[model samples]
Target: MSSNTTQMSIVCISEMKNSKRVAVEEEIIGMVKLNPFLYERKHEMYKNKCMRNKKFNELGKKLNVPAQQLKARWRTLKDKFFQEFKAELIPSGSADEAVKSKWKWMERLRFLENIYTPVDNSPCSSLNISKTVQELQQNMTSLVDRAKIIAEPSVPKSAAQLFFESLAKQTEEAELTPAEFCNLQIEILKALKAASIPNYLQMFCLQQI
Candidate 1:
């Protein structure tokens, strides 16, 4: 074949491949829209299968592709199909507003699931505000304990004296009450004395003070 004819043939073949890919993609999307549950179940299966196969690096080497690239493409296709299926679940506006609102909340939950850690591994698994608050309180307590260790050994006499003196001057300027002034002095003592304490506890107490 002549050079120009060969080039034309190659272009035609490439165009045909592109057209075929587009058609297949559209068909998959249509199937997902028509039967969301089917698609979702299939997607879940694929996700489980992918996770079970831990030797992705070896597989990629055999396939002559980067493992990261293969995994990324797989994830993209999986997410695309999943989203298409979810979109199908949205009812028409004519439906009851309450039903629609419920569906909207469900969709939000799905979105959050995709973005956040899975329930099994999540830090906030219980999804209870009070539980989360309790966890935070525990963490704060631990931090305080660590800080106390770090802050041990009182501040040098000279530093404590200087800090108190400075505080007294400030208290006078601000016209603070005795009680408030005493609190201020306590804070100063903690800050100056904390360095002698252990690293972990010093930070915790200093922060609270």
Candidate 2:
């Protein structure tokens, strides 16, 4: 009876977490609709900082809140939104159902994971792939270093275009919106689909007000 009760408690906790995540996501969606600038590309905000600041100031006056506070709230919401976004990418069902072969890009993931895994040098003759994990780790470190440059608070004039192009090349796709591009880039940098990157570039653009 105790074991069963403990299992039920764990399930209840998981359900509660999911429910809270859903509510937060709904709030974030509403907020984005209320302020479209909250969802705009980092490049757009960077190029039009002055105009964006004026708009924020106007909205701030009406809401009786400082523009900085509004900006900070948006950043917090954005982080939570992306966290949920990453969580949803995880496969929840059976293996066959989890394998989404319809997407060409996803088909490459298995092959890439294999390449990223290094053969082990362990004494066992069974051939372990754990030893060479360092190779992939080093590659991810390099990618993160490059991504950090683009994600810096003081981004350059053409930094957005450059980052987008790099992501497209890395993912072998194009025409992704800023959010999509950022998601893919973050996945590549971390070598996992569930890692979330700090939205410093977006926040940097927003806080310019």
Candidate 3:
């Protein structure tokens, strides 16, 4: 096989293995949820079994054999079969049904196991693409807002005076009653305060009247 093809196959196998691990973890969690007492009693046994299975599967995939093939091979061994059979035969409640459902979901998840390659090695992967795009957009928008502030032209004193004069003119032209003007001025003062601007500017503007 070509190097690229081999690399792609390895990536596929790695992803499949990860999916299987996740599925197995989910199954264990489901079993624990269904029978917390049993899980607590056999916690160490379950932990060791899961770790051994995960390691065996990962090694098998690295060697190019399917994870299921490794599991099948292990199942055929006399000792493995005896242990598994004994575990299965142990008396238990209806909790096995929940575990079965979790395994069924895992089986479905296997269908998506090879959907993407690792992000660092492959640009074509779509894993978490939407989240990446949203984060990039937010960063870009923040950068643009910062740039606008940094590039803003300084306001001349005459321009400031003219701007306020125009605002006062517009307020008068609105034909507001004395009470309405007072309310508008109060709102303007509040906005300035909220923006952390010195109150002296507002006081000066008001005093000009």
Candidate 4:
């Protein structure tokens, strides 16, 4: 064949391969869409390895691909789609988009954002908060026990001052944003107010407001 004909033949082969890859991706997505439990966090199937694998096996039978292969494609497709999805969400003009945000997969996987996006959880919604509260309770309990003792004539610090002095020491190295501090304070104050005994620090903070 002539050099020009040889180049044309190679181009045709490449295009055919690309077309087949697109078709396979479409088939994979179509199968997964029918079984959202495969990706959705809220689905029990997602948490159950046995059930999820059973479903993948079923999908593989129909797609004529191995279960592991389908799982891999799911991951790769979601990974690429999320990259574009995030870039698309960035504050930018339409002209700033990275070549239609990789239109190939974004359009197909855009709807998966709810399932794939990392959960935005409150800072206080963690084990650290529990530990913080537990420490706070222990400190407060120690203070209440101390309060029962008769005050020495030389005790210059006021009840509020002493309580806050301990707090300042406890939180000395802790770095908390204003919002996180306020959220934690609100939760702590609410719990204190709910209890039958009134707290001196709570009363002091409320008086300052």
TM-score of each model, in listed order:
0.25, 0.33, 0.24, 0.45
Poorest lDDT segment (10 consecutive residues) of candidate 2: 121-130
Q: lDDT (0-100) at residue 14 of candidate 4?
A: 22
Per-residue lDDT of model 2, residues 1-209, tens digit only: 34544322112212346665444334434544555444543234534677667756665555445666556655655544444443344343443112333432232222222212223321211222112333434443334335545545587634434544543354444444434434543333333222232334322322221
What would the per-residue lDDT of candidate 1 be over residues 1-209, giving only the tens digit for each residue? 55654322212212346665444334333433443342233244445554434444554444444555445544455454344433333223444111223332234224322332223333323222212323434433433433323334574434333333443454456664333333333333233333333433433333442
Ranking of predictions according to TM-score: 4, 2, 1, 3
Question: Tens-digit lDDT track for model 4 on 104-125?
Answer: 7677776676643323354444
Q: Using TM-score, give the best candidate's number.
A: 4
Model 1 residue 134 lDDT score: 36
74: Cα error in model 4, Å: 0.9
**lDDT tens readout by residue for model 3, 28-122:** 33433453332232234544666556655665555555556544443333233233332332223534211222333334333222222123322
Best by lDDT: 4
lDDT of 2: 0.40
Model 3: what TM-score? 0.24
- Candidate 3 Cα deviation (angstroms), residue 194: 0.5
Q: Flag the better candidate by TM-score, 1 or 2.
A: 2
Give the residue spans of candidate 2 off by over 4 A. 1-38, 42-46, 93-182, 185-209
**Which whole-number lDDT from 0 to 100 does residue 127 have in model 1?**
29
**Global lDDT of each model?**
0.37, 0.40, 0.39, 0.55
lDDT for 179 (candidate 2): 41
Model with the higher lDDT, candidate 1 or 4: 4
